[model samples]
Target: MMGEFRDFVARGNVLDLAVGVIIGAAFGKIVTSLTEDLIMPVIGFVTGGVNFTNKFVLLGAVPESYTGSQTDYAALKAAGVPMLGYGAFVTAVISFVLMAFVIFQIVRAANKMAPAKPAEAPAPAGPSEVDLLTEIRDALKKA
Candidate 1:
C-alpha cells in the first residue's frame, strides 16, 4: 500500500494535476486582482464614474447605506437584506469574459509553441532470404 501510494505520487499525471491546481489558484488571484485593482476602476471611470457593484436595493431595513465592492454581495445576504445585485453580476460577467479571453490567448500561444511530432521512419529495404537463396541457386546453376 505504501509502495502503491509512493508510485501514485511519483506518477507524472499526479504531479501535473498538482501543478495545474497551484497554477490555477495563482491565476485566479491574478485575475481577481486585475479585476478589482485595475480593470474595474478604469471601466468605472470610463462609464461616467458609475460603480456597478454598489448598485443594489436592500430588502430589509439597514440603518446606513451599503458601501462596499461586489465581493460584499454576501454581506447583504448576511444582513438579511434582499438586493438586486445587477452591478455585481455585471462585474462578474466582465471578469469571466476577461479571464476566458486571457486563457484562450495563452492556449493559442502554447499551441503555437508546441513541438510537432516527428515523421515516421521509412521501411527497411531488403530482399527476402528465400529470394536471395533462389538468386544464389540460379547463379550457381549458370556457373
Candidate 2:
C-alpha cells in the first residue's frame, strides 16, 4: 500500500498537477492584486470615484439593538440584517472578466512565441502498392 502510494505520487501527471496548483494559487493572488490595486482604482477614477463593492440593498428591518453602522455591509450582516451585496458581486464579476482577459492574452502571446510544428513531408510520388500489383498481374496475363 505504501509502495502503491509512492508510485502514484511519483507519476509525471501528479507532479504536473502539483506544479499547476502552485502556479494557479500564485496567479490568483496576482489577479486579485491587479483587480484590487491597479484596475479598480483606475476604474473608480474614470467613473467619478464610485465604489462598486459598497453597493447593496437592505432586505430586512434594521434591529433597534444593532450598534454597527447601517450602510456597512459587514456591519449590517453582523447585526443580523439581511441584505443583497450587489456591489461586491459586480466587483467579483469584473475581477473574473479581467483575469480571463489577461489569461487569454497571455495564452495568445505564448502561442505566437511557440515554435510551429514542422510540416510533414509529402508522400513519395509513385504508383501505390495496389496499382503495382495490378500492373504485375496484367503483365503475367499478357505473358
Candidate 3:
C-alpha cells in the first residue's frame, strides 16, 4: 500500500495537477484583487463614485448587541445582521468572469503555439498472398 501510494504521488499527471492547483490558487487571488481593487474602483468612479460594496438589502432587524452603523454592510454583517449581500456577489461574479477570460486566452495562446500533428500516410497497395501462390504454382508446372 505504501508502494502504491508512492507510485501514485510520483506519477507525472498527479504532479502536474498539484502544480496547476497551486498556480491556479495564486492566479485566483490575483484576479480577485484586480476585480475588487482596480476594476470596481474604476467602475465606481465612472458611475459617479457609487461604492458597490455597501450595496445590500436588510433581510431582518439588526441584532440588539450590534453597535455598528446601519449603512455599513461589512460592519453590520460582522455584528450578525441578516442581509442579502448582492454587491459582494456581483464582485465575485466579476472576478470569476475575469479569471475565466484570462484562462481562455492562455489556452488559446497555447493552442496557437503548439505544433499540429501531421496526417498519417496511407499504406501502399500490394498483391494478395493467393495471387503470389498461384503464380508460384504456374511457374512450378512450367518447370
Highest TM-score against the true fold, candidate: 3
Better of 1 and 3 by TM-score: 3
- Each model's TM-score, in the order given? 0.68, 0.76, 0.83
User: 18-132, model 3: which lDDT tens digit per residue?
Assistant: 9999999999999999999999999899999978899899999988888779999999988878899998888999999999999999999999999998998888878799999
Looking at model 2, report the run of 10 residues with the lowest lDDT sum. 69-78
lDDT for every model?
Answer: 0.82, 0.87, 0.93
Ranking by TM-score: 3, 2, 1
Give Cα distance to truth, residue 44, candidate 2, Å.
2.5
Pairs in clash, predicted candidate 2? none
Q: For model 3, where is the 10-residue window of minimal lDDT?
A: 118-127
Q: Estimate, for each residue in 2-102, the C-alpha lDDT of model 2 and write its tens digit.
A: 99999999999999999989998898889888887888788888999977666799997999998777678878877778889987887788889987998
Q: In candidate 1, which residue pairs clash? A: none
Which structure among the candidates has the greatest lDDT? 3
True-structure lDDT of candidate 3: 0.93
- CA-only RMSD, every prediction: 7.0, 3.2, 4.3
